[model samples]
Each structure stands twice: as C-alpha cells, then as structure tokens.
Target: MITKSDSTTIKSYLEDSSNLHGGHADKVLIPENTAELSSILIECTSKKMPVTISGGGTTTTGSRIPFGGIVVSTEKLNRIISIDKRALSCVVEAGATVDDLQSACGKEGLFYTSHPTEKNAFLGGTIATNASGARSYRYGPTRKAVKRLKMVLATGEIFELRRGEKLFTGRGVSFGLPGGRRIEVALPSYDMPNVKNAAGYFVKDDMDLIDLFIGQEGTLSVITEAELGLELKPPEIRSCFAFFKDEENSWAFAEDLKGKKEWKILSVEYFSENALKLLRRKNPNVPPASRGAIFFEEEGEEGQRYSAADRWLKFIKTRGGSVDDTWVAMNEKDAENFTSFRYAIPEAVNEIVKASGFRKFSTDIAVPGGNFLEMMRFYKDLFRDDGIRNVVFGHIGENHVHANALPVQGAELRRAESICLEFVKKGVSLGGTVSAEHGIGKIKHMYLKEMYGDKGISEMVMVKKALDPGAILGLDNIFPKELLQ
Candidate 1:
C-alpha cells in the first residue's frame, strides 16, 4: 500500500513539522488508511527502523520527530466516522482536530469539554498526552471523555477497545476464538487518581481496558479512532475579570472562590508581570494597569449573577484586590474577546522566542493546595535571584502553574537549564510533579524519576516492555536509555 512515490511526498511534508530540539527526521511514511498503515508499520518493524508519530506539532516535550529513522504522521487520517447522539458519544479518526470536533458537536447543541490550548491538535496526540486544560479543574481531562478506542499495536495488529469490556487477544476480530480459546488478554492495572493526570499510562486493578491506552504516548499503540462522551453547553454564561495588586492577594481570592458553593468557576488563572506584557502585546486595548487576571464563568438563573458578582467584589475589596477592568459577556463576541486574552499567551511566547532568536523552555509543576503559596513565593524568589525573566501562569485553581523560561541562547542557555533542574528538585521536595500536562517525551525524561521514585519508574519501564517488546514506537523517547543506565 505504501508505494515509493507515497514515501517521497509524505516524507517531505512530514519534515515540515519537525521543528523540535535535536532535529527533524530524514524519512517519513504516511498511510491513508488502516490497511496501508499496517503494511508500512510492518515493513518498518521488520527493517528495525525507529518510528515516531506526530499530530499538530504542538508537543512541548519534543515527541514528534524521530531521533534516527522515520516519522509516521496521522494528519491525513482526519475523518469523523459517526455521531451516536443517543449514546452521547462520537466516533472520529485520530487526526481530526479539536476545532473540527468542537464545530461538529456545536451543530447538535452538544459540547466536547476537553479544551486543549492548541485547537489544531489532533485527537491522537491529545489521547497520547491525555491532554487537559483550564476546565480540567471541573470536567477532568481527555481520559474522562473517551469511551472507546481503535488502536494499532506495535506488532501491527489493530484492536478496538470498548469501555467495561476486555481486550481481545485471540485472532479474527472476535471476542472469543474457536478451539476453546479465551480471546481476551488482561493488562496489569493501577488505580488512576481521580484528579487530572496527563503524565503517563493510567493503570489500576479492575480498571477499564481503555485506560491503558489513554496516556501511553504511542509507546503501546497508535490510536486510529476514538469514541468520546459529550455534554450539554451551559445555558447562560458571564465572564468576570478580577485584578490583584500582588500574587498574595490574588491567591487569597482564589482560595475564597474555591469555597463558594453557588458559582461554577470554570477557570481561575494567574499571570506574572512578564506574562502581562505578552498579554498587552496580543490585545493592546486591555488596560495597562492590570497586573494579574482571573476569568470566571457563571451558569444557571439570573438571580445568582448579582450574588456571585457581589461576593467577588466584596472579597477583592477586602483583600485589597483592584479591578483594572472587567467585561461581562451576554453574547458570543464579548466572550471571544475575554477568552482571547487567556489563549494569547502561547502564541505570544512563540512570537517572542522567534524574534529573540532563542529556544523556548517551560516547566509545569503542581503542588498541594496548602503549599501552593509557599511554592509560588519560592519560584518568584528563585527567578528574581537568578535574574531570569520568564512568564508564569496556568490553572491556578488546581495549583498547577506553567513557568516559561524566556528565550535564551549560548552559555546562558546552559545556566538556565541548570536553574530549571534546581527548580525541578525543589518542586519534587515540595511534593509536586515536575511535568504536569506535558508528557515526559525526551526533554523531561531525565526528571521523571525526580517526580516519581525509582520504583515507580521501573514499573513504567516494565509496562513498556510488556506492551512493546521491540521498543519500536517512540523508542528511547519517553523513558530513554540514559535513564536506565
């Protein structure tokens, strides 16, 4: 199915997205359908060529490019199979973009709540990373919405995993086989935390068969299609922006909001001074005095609106939090303007990095709620002492913050990396995870153990070996050889 001509153009096109740390791949393979995909993969496996799969090229962890051999991209596999409205689920090809799915669901008055920042991110990559966003504090991550998956195993076997069902082991696409053979192979399970977990493979005893593939990052299998659950869009929404003089007052306000029972706060975010500069560049109309911002959404009766706003006003007033500006959106246009501020940070970072001729590095860490203030204080002091100018912000509601190191090159870059290592060590010491939403990939593989103990990492390696004996898929990417050494 993969002709010589197919390899030429596919390889050329695939190289376009390999803007990663090390470099791009020399060769690439693109299969239009599952059969062709299987054929290409089998050939690559037999030839012992290392392979990596890519989606939107938004992987901050550098998982898109192959270190040596070939890269396989699922970009062409974009198609929505079916939407089972009655079941509140939709089956779609892995390459379908988040925007595509959200648009389709919008037509039926339904909403797909998983809102990763990159709208162009393919479903496959999101599943691989188990991606989450601001709403993760309320609706959870991508794993919660996925019900079934059709994945291509490393051995080139395509399997369909259903919720509350077993994985078929025997041949012929049947749950059971002739000759008295049981058809299912039970995978070892681990109890996944109910909170957002986008790090690695989610496993637990008595866990659903689908959980194993949720965040495996293409090491275990390449997902082709998935069935995702949907929810109804909120009826009436309002956006409120609260600005604080400093991090302490803003954090205190966040804590108070967390205890409120009536309001459904969708996203509570914080921005450092550097982040504010970027936001201003993206939206010059935004008031310059705004140091920090918080976006809140309220649903249900109009009676609750006044009360919610009044409570927030009182809290901020008491905590010395000032309101530089605020916008309440009764319609879609106003809502878009409000969200633009929140979404512009990533784009701004990209622009700044390109303009400054420096590479971008970010650290995402989550500390316990009780230790969050202390953690922020420590990071602020660290950055100030080191004279590192960076942007820091994320889902403050969940105690997860993404501190992005400003673009730096040459010897300064090495110094920045060393500072990052120290930050990682401090984060681990404070009972925080090193990489929160981003997967380990290659850049952060060394810090995986620092977040999770040696025993935990060893178990991860064991699972990887059990699923992919040849280590062909994303080989030496997530859990590299150096770590084992």
Candidate 2:
C-alpha cells in the first residue's frame, strides 16, 4: 500500500470533470491488491472515516471527488486477470482502463461493445455507473456487458457475484457471504424508464442481485473486478457525416436510420447548429448552410462495403441531405478522426464552462421514442427563448440528447441551472430518465429526486445503508449525504 498525506500530492484527486469545488481530503491511499484494499476499508470503517473510491477521474458527475475523506484510488490495482477467447469474455481489475481493455481484446478479434467514448475511463468506474456510449445503439449499456462483479463492502467484506445466480424475492434480496455474514436489501419500487438510463440504483421486479451494485455509484460497495462479455469485431465499419440544412431534416434522417434494421447501424449521433459552431473552430470543413448534422456508423463484410456506401448516398439524398456537404470515412484512420469530431463537442463545451468560471450544467435526459420529437421541440423552444448560449448533441438512436448550457456571467449561470432543472422535470414527465449514461453523482441529486419521489429516494438509501452500514463510501453520490442519517 502507498499513502500520500501531503495536500499538494492529494490535490489532483479532489476534482473530476464536473469541476465541482470545495473538495478536500486528508490523505490518498493506493492499495495494490484486494487484501490491501479490504484492510484499508476495515481501518476506515473502524475510525468512522469516509472513503471515496477513485477511478479514471473522467466522470463529469463529480462522483470521485472527496469532500472529507481518505481517497482510495484503484490505480495501482490495475490488472487484466484473464481473457477467454472462446467464451468471448474477459476479467479485469478495477483500475484497468477502457483503452487497455480494448487494445487487449482487439488482439483477439473481440470488442468491448459497451465502452464509453472516453478511452481513459476505468472499466470499474464504467461498470459502477452502468455507462453507455456511441456503440450502445447496437450493443446495450455496461449493465448488459457485465457478466460478473467482485465487490468489497464498507465493512471490508469481499464477495463475488455472477448474473442470474441470485434473484430478488418480491422486491427483496439476500446475499450470504464469507464468515457467516449475510446482507439483505429491499429494492426501490419505482419503475425505471423504458428508455436509456443510468440515473440512480437499477431496480426492477425480481431483478438480479448483482444489478443492485452495478449502478449504485459506489454508494453500496467498491467494485474491485469485473467479468465482461465481448463481441466479435466487425470486418468493416462505414462512418458518415450527413449535413442537413435544418434540425428537422437531421431529426428525420436519424429516425429513418433507426427504423432500418437491415442497415446494421452501430450508432446514430446528432449535433445542433450551435454544436457545429464549436466544431468549426477545430475543423473549418463544416458547411455554412448546415444547421444540423447526423453522424452514423454501420458494419458489414468487406465485399459489401461498396454497395453499402452507394445505398447510404441514396438515403442521404432522399433525406434532404447534401452529398457535396457530407463527409465519409472509408478507412480506420479517417474513422477515428470522425470519432474525435464527435467527442470534440463535449470537450469544447467544457472549455467554455471552465473559462466562464461556473460549474458545468448539462442534461443527460432520455425520453421514450414516441415522445422524442416533443422533447426535442421543447429543448429548442426553451433554448431559443432563454438567451443563454448552449449546444445540443448525443446518442439520438436512444433518444438521449445532451443539452449543455454555457453561461459566461453569474446571472446567466443561475438561469442555466434553472433551465437544466426544467429539462429534468420535463424528461421525467415524458416517461424518460433524468440521466441516461452519466450516473447521478454529487451534482444531480436533486434531479434524481425529481425522477424518483421522496419515497423512492428513501428506499434507495435503505439499500445503501444495508450494504454500507458506516455510510463511508461515496458519501455524496446519487443523493445527499444527510439522507443516510
């Protein structure tokens, strides 16, 4: 184990991409093995000291930021335990980053389908939040990819759980562990949205016991290792950027693309006029008349690549898209460039928020397919009238779009927060989730309450307390720390 008590050395662990302030920690502890990690937790629990588990530090939710605790980072525990090529699965430690896993799996002609776009993100952190990314349109979220998880409770109890091994019995689950100890938790009764979600605890009728900890945001237990399923890598991927004159054309293109199952679409992403404005800063290739754009990817055999490109060109023309303005990447190098373009939106938004000196406020809301157009219109109406600079982009195939409000002044920042809350309420009313991929960390506690009422929150807290009696893990994640009392 390694420990750093100096404030200067511990400063980097105090913040995440959320840019939340006032975070402080007494020490930073790096444990190399599960036993070392358990011993540290045991001592912290005895002292009633809060312990915040740190991963890649890439989360925008501020989940890893410690308010007052000894930060326990998983960096040194990094390891790829095993890879079963025949079973299409791999087991990795909590500190193994997605980039490392992808490279390892790629050598075996396998792919980590549910990996988030951020390459530096740790596998355990992604599992803790049930993260989903661009390819999630074809392959589901991290919850689906996870086959097993090894977790350590706040009491220093370690246990391994596999999917379908234990199930809920009428909204209750009981887990028997080592040393003759057992933990029972009551599931939250709230019905999760049918759309994409990573909001709060994943709860369902007769849900798998392993799911209880998957999206708990480290509030229940520390995820130590994960056994994840993989997919066969596609032979050829077709990436395209179709520029439209307006939002309606782009929306129609996305909807049409989603309905086509034979197209083998891997992702359907959207970008607004404002988002394109930011991209123009990096790449001046954006057409002036293009107010909106849809970037999509499809996979097929090498022989079918040429035919697929022809079909896509015809479809784009029919959807009011300009072939002259469109950009297509036929090779791997160009495809990666297209991906970087997609990621540039959020990076640009973060830069604006940082320069403005205000905390980031962005919507991760996802609505049902039928209600998506209404939700999109609602966003446009509010954004147009609000007078605050903003940009919209995200996974349109799942009807989950991110609207980032860029406030340069104090008053604008206050109004931006209010407008974001409105987005949350509207999403919930439309039978959507307050958060789709980004889990409710310290920042979105109130939004979680809006989605799940007071009773829903209380039930979730009960589950957390059952696993973490000391209430020392992830103190402010998903809900306020005071609620645990």
Highest lDDT: give the candidate number.
Answer: 2
TM-score of candidate 2 against the unseen true structure: 0.99
Worst 10 residues of 1 by lDDT: 170-179
lDDT of 2 by residue, 1-485 (tens): 89999988988899888888888999999998899999999999899899999999988999999999789999987898888999999999999999999999989998899858788999989988899999999999999999999988899988899999999997998879886798888888999999998999998899899988887787888899999999898998889999999998999999999999888899999999999989999999899889999999998887565677678889989888867978888778888899999989888888887787778899999999999999999999999999789999999999999999888888787799999999999999999999999999999999999999999999888988898898899998999999988
Task: For residues 32-65, write the lDDT of model 1, one tens digit per residue.
Answer: 9987787767777777667788787777776665
- The CA lDDT at 444 in model 1 is 76
State the lDDT at 302 in candidate 1: 47
Q: Provide the lowest-lDDT 10-residue window in model 2.
A: 301-310
- Residue pairs with backbone overlap in model 1: 189-204, 190-203, 190-204, 191-204
Best of the candidates, TM-score: 2
